[model samples]
Target chain A: MKENYDIVIIGGGPAGLAAAVSAYDNGAKNILILEREPRLGGILNQCIHNGFGLTRFKESLSGPEYAYRFIKEVEARDIDVLLNTTVLSLEDNKTITAINSEYGVFSITPKAVILSMGCRERSRGALNIPGSRPAGIYSAGTAQKYVNIKGYLPGKRVVILGSGDIGLIMARRMTLEGAKVLAVCEIMPYSSGLRRNIEQCLNDFNIPLYLNHTITKIEGTSRVTGVVVSKVDENKQPIEGTEMHFDCDTVLFSVGLIPENELTKGAGIEQSRNTRGAVVYQNRETMIDGIFACGNVLQVHDLVDFVSEESEIAGACAANYVLNGRQEHNPISCINGDNISYVLPQKIDKNIPGNVKLFFRVRNTFKHCKIVVESNGVVLQEKKKLICVPGEMETVILSSDVIAKAEGDIVVRLEC
Target chain B: MNKQLTCIECPMGCLIEVEVENGAVKSVKGNTCLRGKMYAENEVICPLRVVTSTVKTVSGKMVSVKTDKPVRKSEIFEVMKKINSLTLDRNVVIGDVILANIDRDANLVATQNYND
Candidate 1:
């Protein structure tokens, strides 16, 4: 095996696969992808439902299909892929300590590194729902894997908590598999899933969606027997008398996803408190000279297309860092203001002479609002949006000239 | 008759109202694009969706598959039954036809390779 490479992309999911392909296409030949999973497709292998790749492929494809396209592209270019390789530690100096069954513990120092380790679903422990720790309670993603990949039904009666895409999709999936989906309870006033999913998954199947509600208690001893649902007030505190019990056998939690950044944390990379991922510049390069990050590792993205797009930038930037030496540039911090929760590429390198797309999510739902970007007390750009939700990600592009001329922090705010 | 539907043509998901007369779409309103109008009309006439599910392989591993074309919405459960009952006895790659002529104008095709 090669001891050194121009670029090493961690996590062979859609993000890493796309990054490797993009890096190879842009003159980085000696690139390798390290995937912890036995398969190269990552979580896409378990996502059997369609409605992916509409932006990148122009056709609705299943998750596996979308991932296979990139896998095929990587294979065609003869890009090196190491599967079942778990990366243990990532050093600040671009050294990756990895281990595999075939090859024992080994250290590889690439010229540059791209972190694409995607996010994981929030588990029951995080929710802290009052309950007897028992069987039949699974994360929506874990249940998805059991049903879609392992061909096993988790339970006959299911109660899904959270109206996110996976929970909604599983509501339909469990129904198709002959399970009675009692209800989908969301803690928020608005669903954290796409409207299309709500329409197609829950609405089409006649499953009731309870908004501004949460599970008050789990009533079961050996397994999940039922759950008590209750409405929450403005402060997210459960209304005492609103508790309603529903008898169910299974409980699926679809709360949220957290970016897997243990390696980044280990490397002592600067992280965003909002995104829970690495803080990076417009080029997706972290504060560290040769290290970069993209995809869900930087911030959890709604669509794989956006992940591919972001990783492409990271891949290109890493390749440039290896081929051409690192360039010194004046950088400005990007600040999230008002209703805006967080913005990606938290910093903009003024030296990069191109438009930088700032992707962000609102803290709450709003209708008919304008996204305003300001820098140096000057309004650089503003765009109107009819509706905005935390579930759906939004993007605005800023010209390099605007970033370069900025003397203060770049601020993105929503004016309703 | 008046029918309300959401246009799934794109992410906009316009709320479309369709007026149906004599089993035909008379008009579609509140749709922002022609695709939405067409979608409303088709949804009023006959809703269709691509069915995705997994079939057991010879090695006992489940392989994900989907219809090559849209299946009539009314027959989704029926098609799903057919899909659930099916079991492939050989290795298959993506795009391999698992079942031919599944429902109206549809073929069950593998979305991922099952080497095992």
Candidate 2:
């Protein structure tokens, strides 16, 4: 109904909602959230699981609950919400072209923009699973969405090919509703999901989890009926003699998640193959002026609360941009070093908030290591932790005071 | 004291700053509408959450289920008490309402993909 204004947020997930809310709180009043789904809620609609909202709200809430909290916040604010609206592209300094079934197509030039389109699942095609093209094969996330949100059962007896979080969760999910989960097979020796999930969701249920294994063959005609699982060696090569076959109607693949960056890429933002995402500043701002990204669109996080936190930062910054028009703050280079997989803030600014949370992931599992944050190779700050696992994301907070003193680039590295 | 409130209604997360003056909400600030205000007030007091997770089944599968409606956030662990006590009957379909009464009020619905 309205023409153009302050902020235009893409995707109606938790990140988009948080960005819109935080932007308004910081004084960017004119805001709009465009969601492609029939309604808001995004992936949380299908998540239907707990372990959410622990950080944002002291209570453990489900995905829907976490999303609803922000949804409720967005409704309270005067931010315009446009659901069932798909953003076609972004061009020419945050100019947006989007369409909804009800409203044809429209273009808007927002002063500031936030992108929270989330991510996508690695389908069976992405995984060279070396099997027949079958009807029963389904991505664990897709199966989850249909089963949990859309209220459709995907299979009867299932063999999950990957031990990712969604697959692991689905293993337990299918079992609860009276389906027999034969086994959860993982290619890598180590599981990609959180350890607690393995112990509680799979082990407690008396389900077998086969590590260092891969699904060799899928057997079925018009429907799925059987699958062959083979053991893998140290290098993850499938061993010949270790092949085991099972009779099952469904095969769920829980391989991996990929950031949805078609819009980001089309925007011509600088991207890194390592992260598969556009390089952004400390404030979650993309390389382009007045454009920002957060949540899975920026980085994949194990917990939605971190997504909420990052989106809040993105939201506040977008609001600041609307109110103050292009912040003139000193920048500090951010780098990943040592065992550190990657540092979130590719760069930093002088006027960061009092509690600035820097998110990152580790290269591999490590125990009792020191995470040192350095400036110009000098140890500025370091924290020792008992455990750091690649499955779980790590966050370090440096007070605004410490950030103000930084002159050159900042580096995060892991040391013994 | 009226705590500034925002609706946690849907994923929209309507931000409303509510003013609570004497242990009671005085006025809500920054919400789009009344739905958001009521949502924020409810969030301040009895925030409800749904529980969807895996439960052990005799068939060696993990069945996912959720409380039919949202339950009090404080009652999540308690509600799981009922879920822990539950065992699926043979041939249960997806989207079947597993337990309609959780702690006497919460409704638990079975997920669609239960090994099928």
Candidate 3:
């Protein structure tokens, strides 16, 4: 195996796998995927639920299923996949220093790098719930890994806070494993999970979903004793005299997901505060010509299918960059105006072929909505959707014909 | 029967009410689809369900597995008993038969991602 390759992908999850395969298909022969875990699949291994692969497969499949499709593609393509390896540091010169027993602290200087480190689950400490820092408090992702992937129940009685997908899935998973879920408390009036998840994971399980409520404090010592939950006002401040205690052994927090951008940030990439991700080109390339990002590391995707879908673009871009050098000019900026969380591909080169696709998410869920892409108040294209949720991503197509006409900055906005 | 049921045929989530007379559906209402009306009729007599959850595995993921045929509303526990007795050996693929002949006809199958 060569130390230096055309591409160096940071994570070997679905994103890296798809990217590697796509890179191979798109002309880059020497591509490498470095993952920290012993296995390639990242969070998908623990997801274990359906609702993934709807877009990519056109049929519903579980998380692992969706991941295996990409994994199989990479395997079939004979892509280099390195497990139990972590990229220690990345430099401005596209040099990656990675360590593994097989390749101990090797320096690989690739022409380009794709960052797909994925996101990390926010823990209890980040929530600042005033209480004793004790055991039996785990992030929903940790507990999920324990039960779904590791085959060990986290607890017999659990109270999960935050209704993100992992928390909702865990609520049902814990129930089926013979544990009594006290309740799922959400600080907001609505769950952050997909509406389908709320219906399938909680409503079907007969679990009580307390909206506009939260766990004010955790009461535990060595292990876990109980928890103090309370109702809150619109500002999420606990209502006085509304604190209630539930005798549960575990408290799981699924607060939110933070994209792991240490390397991207360290590399001096321009990121968006709204998306908490890097502002990239249509090719998923950051302002740094040779660098790219995809998957949860780019933005927390509701389904793994979209991750696989996006990785292809990143991989193809990296491969194209390695093969014929990236085109540098004719960049058209992408803007996210009101109601839109953020837009990927912050810019696009007019020289590119075909229509460009921009993926984004909304701040709130809407039953019926329109996503409009415009240039200087001139609506370029508009898409109407019957149902749109914040958990699910929305994409708009900007045709090459449209790009040919883009005289000014392209702005993407969502309307209810 | 003194219970109300919702049709899960689709995302419509049709709320349907049913009344049973002489162990059979006597009246059904609030169903938006023909399938929902039929579901209301059958639910009063022999309620069918689509059970989804993870099953124990020897060395694979604790991924979702669905019964080829939904268990009888009253036989969910019995079906689970049978499902518990069986084990998924290593190298089980998706759609692999983990517990065949579940109810003389149905098969308990792996629905999650796996490789044989």
Better of 1 and 3 by TM-score: 1
Query: lDDT for each of the candidates?
Result: 0.90, 0.79, 0.79
lDDT of 1 by residue, A1-416 (tens): 68778899999998898888888888899988999988898888889999889888888889999999999999999578889899999999889999999899999999999999999999988878897987999999999999998899999999999999899999999998999999999989998988778888888789999999999899889998999999999999999999988999999999999999999999999999999999999889998888989899899998888899999999888889888979996888899999999998899888888999999999998899999999877998999999898988999988867776678889999999
Best by TM-score: 1
Query: Which of the CAPRI classes, incorrect, acceptable, medium or high, describes model 2?
Result: incorrect
For residue A15, what is the lDDT in candidate 2?
A: 86
Q: How does residue A208 of candidate 3 score in lDDT? A: 87
What TM-scores result for chain A when each predicted structure is judged separately against the true chain A? 0.98, 0.95, 0.95
Q: What are the clash counts of all predictions, listed in order?
A: 0, 61, 0
Worst 10 residues of 2 chain A by lDDT: A195-204
Q: lDDT tens digits, residues A104-166, model 3?
A: 888888899999999898877787888887778889989888887667888998999999978
List the RMSD of every prediction in angstroms: 1.3, 12.3, 3.9
Worst 10 residues of 1 chain B by lDDT: B6-15
Of 1 and 3, the candidate ranking higher by lDDT? 1
Tens-digit lDDT string for candidate 2 (A1-416): 58887999999898898888899999998999999997677888678777677567866566665777788899998989898899999984788999987789889999988989999988888767666676878888888876665546788999998898899889877776567899999998788887646754686468899998889888987888899999988878889999999999999989888899999999898876656777887788887878999999888888788888889989999888888888765677778889988888786767556656778888887899999998876787889987787777888987887777666888899987
